[model samples]
Target: MSGINWNECSVDFGEASYPYYFGEDCLDRIVASMAGYGADRFLVVTDDNVLQLHGEKLLPALARVAPVDVFSRPAGDGAKSLHNLGACLEQAIAAGASRQSVVVAFGGGVPGNLAGVVASLLFRGVRLVHIPTTTVAAMDSVISLKQAINSTHGKNHIGTYRTPEAVYFDAGLLSTLPSKQLRSGLCEATKNCLAIRPQSIAQMRDRLAAGDLASPQTLLWLLEESLEAKCSVMAQDTYEQRAGLILEYGHTVGHAVEMCDQRLRGSDGLSHGEAVMLGMLAAARISNAMGALDDAAVAVHEELARALGVGTEMPGGLLIEDVMDVVRVDNKRGYLTVSGEEAAMVLLGRLGVPLGSHDLPLTAVPLGIVKEAVATLVPDNQ
Candidate 1:
């Protein structure tokens, strides 16, 4: 933890902008930056596992500047429910939190997203700061303005758009993640490369082959790349409902598989990024079948999946029918006009070229094609 160097970048979404500071072995710098915000109190939102692992290292420093109120839920996607969100709001009020208090999101995507919604709802809106500890949060979720929790019927069904005052992370914290957790963010980054910045595919391949996936250099590279890919598309589209939707390249089907698998396995299911990677595999096949993307391009996705150690096959015990059922209610339904039997999806004509209108990066993909693509991943016995 000796080489502590920090780098700063700005995310400008036309009307608003914020700095994203990141580095290695720099938790102290993150705490110091938060202290400068000069808030009445710091409502640090996180989960049990993160609080146990990295909380002690930064909480004392944060407490030195302002009173700290911690609102924690059991660690997992399940925490992003109405019950937990309401409980967090009540606790913040009960702890004397006010408009001047700042909400600090201090963990992975789940906590970060919940905190974003909490910050937006608390006292109309409080300043929000993100100190993401996981690759998924640091590289993907925290970069955008969307904040949401799952509805009983679908993922991210209940949410709003809220930007953070700033985002900070120490790549050192990611070293503590389990292999599956560590690979999660990179998988999302892979989606960015394939969907937005296909030119970076070679660099991604080199890093994966290098086999030092958790090294600070690799993490930093992924973070920078994600920012570039996402921001380029989101700059003019503040709500991510237009061109920014390209970022959802593999998410339509990926999310359905993820939710279905989560029902069966809970937090033990495929990680979000892993599920999205599989989703991209499905998208690739659908695109190929539709005569948009060629088989060679599809092979590139499979090669990256192998290099990243993520299985391109469907998750075990998952039923294709169940996944199709979820896809029917996909969040991107209205993005394009489709019949009841089709789902709106982002399909690519080639590397870096999405197959859709200039304003929207989605097409209505036939449910039959979607089922066929997903079926390829299922075990024959199923």
Candidate 2:
């Protein structure tokens, strides 16, 4: 893959040119995409934090194309709810946004997911553009059309697969992103690196350790790699049918843990990337118990996660029983139908080599082993 310049590559993930523009000037590319769609009026959805930071820079660029109406919400996990969705919809209507108007999501996963959900539900449907600012958004939430609002039951309980008309990712935005947010995005990129292209994980690990966060060269390369893997998987499983479960390698248990914690607090809490890291650890252990993955491979997976800045350690002193209970209610299965014979958990036999899904015999792995793994993952315990 070396010496072959990615800038010249036809990096189509089975779609016609979903481009990832890098550098400071790349933000304008998002405006150009809206113009291409004949958008005359733009409704921008973001949060207070991003508005204070980059909105000034992005708004003027967008206003040049259409009169831009900005809507802001309190940032963080608390904003991804049915109530906020309603508020945003109210604001959108009050602002005179019509079906012909375009909605631009100008923040991280929360804003992107929130605005995306609004676009899908507004006026039956409206054109939407995603301008993902955070790295985690760049690696996952920013590119997909999946929009969701968390429910008392679980995360993403209410949502749809309404793909945006276009996604504009300016890697230069990474410069403004905080280190933790950058790390969050890297968890997804790390997941892609391991699941789709294990060949480059070592090199990526080195770069991360060296704190090469601002390298335009590295950002450009990593974005292309992650997009290639994720888009290919999405193409084969656009509706998240069976084949798409591959993308949920760590998400099965990840979503459950996230919900369990959020339900206990009655608020949107736990960073998705952090939750997924723990979920990946849990899945790896489950796979190990089922004989799907060996100790060596699991160790390597955990090692890469640590280097990438994901808290692979489970949060709190949660018992295995409580976590498993949440797993039963997870919508990822689409149905509560796990047989006594055991269900297959997706795992990686080796980096870049998807082991596919297989029935994991949980009984095979003693509760003590899982507890030990959990304890070992807790930062305090470590």
Candidate 3:
């Protein structure tokens, strides 16, 4: 660890915190730090694609540190499920996992979340670590404490909060990702600009306009901005049921649309962040119709999405009716008092200003409004 040029930082949750070690081509030192935890075994949770692409960078080093057991599912959003959760848990137990075992989430958000759930449940709570390889996990999901898998009905319905022992990121891994995969996380970064950190909007526009989406400098700025936006909101509400929900600006309709499109096209459809970007566009329209958000702000959403390489339209063959069906069962229903005709959402009255009460930037918008806004993304509303 002496020669390791680690860019050490901390993720502060007020009541809880953990070390986030970031560096270029430093997976070896990162693994050394994880080994310092004095664990007898490592349960590496990852998907097939990540395992194939980047496992060598992590797994061999970990094998030298402790006994490594990997529980891998096929790559894609499909792996985040109750079936995988149950199987991963039961298999870890059968494989001699003990309370002293460390659950290493070794991929993007899908595996990071699956590992989080497994680690939270194993031996009634074991030590957990995150080594995020994807931009979404590194810049967005790992910065927070929320860990979840999708329910049969909607998004993130089955999940809980769990703090990680550490988060290790090597930006070099992101270079191998496809252009589409990279843009997926940029969409979430765009949402942060529109929702929480409005002041950074111009900076982001400048960055996108430069067209250096994969440069080392751009990646560093992306990670820095994400930490600032997510950590600033999470300091007060660790559970994300309050002000932290602002982090979910485009997630409501985004999650619903993502789940629906994934069902139709499997892994080839809209990426999670793309759907969220589209959701932000719809949300902008919804707020405009309600006379809260104006037209120029809505245009900004479109411009950002287009510049980030996201389309403003829905996926081909996806139905407004199916997306609406999932929105009805949106997981935010319990947060506020919404009748069957309404859905709970986070909307803005203007840039940098949320429309709801303090503590919870969430309000009840009629399902009809939600439908109309979403329909604008469809190629043919008729």
Candidate 4:
């Protein structure tokens, strides 16, 4: 009940901290908070779709705080690359950005990440704020300070950690999203229940089955569930290089599948949550093969995927080899040293219980086991 109103929370990331303000249709209030930043100008980092759909409302408000220079990118994960990061910084410089300029991440996770890099690099770090318009960004990405883009080899390959000036969200923006886009957050919520807080599983099932995901109440619940699950892990390990690795639940293989599928289908491919849901399935299978996860726990992953609108089918024509090729150099490698045959992965001994040390939940999953689990999800046509 009290959750529906404007709310503030502290995101204390061990080293850096910021406040997050959120509520339904609270654009005016979010903008009011930005005035305190005292920026000379705001460099709005976003994409074509968000700019077309919601920019008129946000850019005008941001301009009221300071003159706004729009640095828009084409929508999709492709926008988060080293090339775009470099281009965004160059454009911000040409736009007269300075230590007084704030890089506002004004769309989904893609633009949020792009802006994080821009803000961190420009003049060796300036102010950054997040005005997340997508559930994936609000529910998942914005919770951590890890900002990165894809390398030629794998996901999140080139990146840095930069805390934001603050983060803001208006759930109202999510109502305009297509059905396909909703899956990303839903999938992440499922991961939270399965990987971090299994007690929320029943509530999540009811929410999904009710299927009113667009309502403000449901959106609030989704955000809260994500925050409870993630903040539980991230509050201590702000960098997410240690115990917070549990938050990556299915991302290891999920990122690989998502990258390969996006190459084939572009934005129409699996949303990040869908791909990660599939990745959880693979992770569960891998765990079961190792005698860690039970059949019942594995079954829950399947149930949540179906309830959350994720099918087990891998992207058609995406070879296991291609997925493995990406997984081979998965960005999580350096966190723990494993041989060439193993991968650093987050697996579960059971729901809400990661397999490794709670301090460092990541372990070296063998490549063969990883490939076999992923193969089980491949579509028959492929």
Q: For each candidate in the order shown, give its overall lDDT on alpha carbons.
A: 0.89, 0.68, 0.88, 0.88
Off by over 4 Å in 2: 1-22, 259-270, 317-325, 335-337, 340-344, 353-382
Q: What is residue 37's positional error in candidate 3, in angstroms?
A: 0.9
lDDT per residue as tens, model 1, 178-275:
98988898899999999999999999999988988888778878877998998899889978999999988899889888888888888888889999
Q: Candidate 1 vs candidate 2: which has greater TM-score?
A: 1
TM-score of each: 0.97, 0.84, 0.97, 0.97
Pairs of colliding residues, candidate 4: none
True-vs-predicted CA distance for residue 71, candidate 1, Å: 1.7
Worst 10 residues of 3 by lDDT: 1-10
> Per-residue lDDT of 1-382 in model 4, one digit per residue for the tens?
1346588888776667788888877888888888888899999999999999998888888787799999887788899888888888888889888899988999888899888988888999998899998889998899889888888787888889988878898888887998877877888888989988899999998999999878788887888888788878877788888989999889999999999998898877888988999999999999999999999999998988888877888977899999999998888888888999999999999999999889988878899999999899888876
Residue pairs clashing, model 1: none
lDDT of the structure predicted as candidate 4: 0.88
Question: Which one wins by TM-score: 2 or 3?
Answer: 3
lDDT of candidate 3 over 254-353, digit per residue (tens):
9989999889888787888899998888888999999899999988888888898878899778888899988899877788898989988989888877
Model 3 RMSD in Å is 2.0
What's the lDDT for residue 87 in model 4? 87
Best by lDDT: 1
